[model samples]
Target: MVTTLLTPVGDAPWSTEEFESRLRAVPEERYHDRHAFNIRMHSGALSQAELRCWIANRFHYQRHLPVKDALITAKLPTPALRRMWLRRIQDHDGLEEGEGGIERWLRLGEAAGLDRETLLRGDTVLPGVRLAVDGYVNFCRLRPPLEAVAASLTELSAPDLIRTRVAAFERHYPWIDPDGLAYFRSRVPQSRRDGAEALRLVLSWAYTRKDQERAVAALRFACDVLWSLLDAVAHEHCPEGS
Candidate 1:
């Protein structure tokens, strides 16, 4: 059902503008930022337990960010591309111990009342959440480099989401420490930079109809992955329907 919603390949190669439109269309239609779980989060409807559950499960996805980036970097064909992609890995992993997005996410977990050790160990990651994240990682590992880059175009929507989330957390979830909000705050600029680079790469590399179709499909698949992650979180914490 999700695959069926992707922009279909056409006989004629799309113009660059058309391809950009098709790529942007995925987030409008299917980005997980539209999911009910996130709507509740933004509206301050989630209970503290519900919020903690989300943070704990989402940490699993956060931990895999660099792994997926590494896979994409390994597949890049040029030193320039590899050099550009390596920044994504570093953004998540940091240059030294106890830094980067993953560490900041742990602080978020702790602020939300989740045990830091338990969060780091990832023992409570929901089954569906694990599968969705692993699927994205495997996609990066096995797909063509262009498709993998295209998948990361999900970052296009992330900066706006991070901004909204930061404001929501401050306005609604005041119990969380200000310092623990660093993860979302830090991502706003980083995602803008990363998304621009990924979009440029997709536009330049996927020049033909077939390649453009694959790029669109890859982005659609990524949307599905994120949506599935939220679906899992919702099922676990809001089973009666939020």
Candidate 2:
């Protein structure tokens, strides 16, 4: 669901604010924050199993983040951009093992009563989750660097979502160790920093009408990836006492 499209049917490139506005608009309607499962989650209505399902399945996407980021890192045209982007990969993968976002997520899995090896093995990962996550990786691999980076623009909406998610978990799911929430906590500031850099790159590189449109299209596509992920999760896991 974290992959990284659309047009307003316009014929010209927009001004800087207008271009950024268009990018922001996609998530307004399409962000997975509005998904039924996520809405249920925010309401603190999800059962323990449902929450564990989300935690484990999201790990599928989480593990691939560095892979796709590495692809983006390779495509960055300059050392300055590359250096800026390398932090994203490191943030997820960590400077060393037993550190960073991926490890923190494994801890999240453990806190949800999932075994680290089992989550890493991915035996329970649904076909749809795999497909959607793989699509996200291929997107970064094959698309223009501009579009690839734009796809990551999902980070633009992430800080707020993480904020609400953390609060919801703390409020509604007290059974989960607050310590397990580090990944979400860390991402609030990290996403903000990353979102700013990504928007800058998108604005600086997407100078033409076509590229601007492609950026928007990529954002919409990212939105779809997130929605599809939730659909799969919701379909497979029924809430308690349903």
Candidate 3:
């Protein structure tokens, strides 16, 4: 009979060292070094067409932010926690149309020469992109509250990425209009604040073997989701150097 290998569950409540170690490893192993969008952005190698494609495709990701936030908010049991999380949705969606993160991203898209309709259609999304984002929302919905919070640890690596991205935009996309880069610039501080809060919530709440295991699993899944999204973007957009 064929049998699957039984990997260590790591489910028991973890010490602070165990928790942090798991957290650190997720990004190191799974973050988006392989994503073409990031590779191009970091290397200052993206053409205007590549930049435009990145903006156009990223619209789907921005549009889904509030939907996932709503799913998370629905699961929170306390009014205080719900209220705290509500701000997260508002930050992405804003009080009106043509505002907030999505709008800012749209501005970036337009600057990259993509139209609003094409950006919004979602038809152009690469297959792996949907899988990664769907996995993220699913992980958030299925995991315990502490574990779900832990999954947001993608933010831990995000601030550094945001800085690099901002510099890359300035250096490489000089003709893309500085105002259009506001979305990337805006996210750096937001990522830091959100990452810190999510880390605090996870570290403070996950105090048992089962909880630690679940937290680590959630973080691993989150990293996979992020890495997969970039992989799809790279595969579909860059295509091994065309």
**Considering lDDT, which of the candidate structures 1 and 2 is the better prediction for this target?**
2
Lowest-sum lDDT 10-residue window in model 2? 3-12
Candidate 2 clashing pairs, residues 3+ apart or interchain: 1-225, 1-226, 5-217, 5-218, 5-220, 5-221, 6-217
In order of appearance, the predictions have TM-scores of 0.93, 0.93, 0.87
Error of 1 at 60 (Å): 0.4
lDDT of 1 by residue, 99-166 (tens): 89999999988887678988878777899999999999999999989999999999999999999999
lDDT of each: 0.90, 0.91, 0.76
- Tens digit of lDDT per residue, candidate 2, span 1-242? 77435546576678999999889999888999999999999999988989888888899999999999999999988999899999998999899879999999999888777789988999888889999999999999999899999999988999999999999999999988889999999999999999899999899998789999999999999989989989999999634311
Q: Which residue pairs collide in model 3, if any?
A: 11-209, 12-209, 13-208, 13-209
Clash count of each predicted structure: 0, 7, 4
Predicted structure with the largest lDDT when compared to the true one: 2
For residues 158-204, write the lDDT of model 3, one tens digit per residue: 88888988888888778777898898888999988988888877788
lDDT, candidate 3, equals 0.76
Candidate 1 CA-lDDT value = 0.90
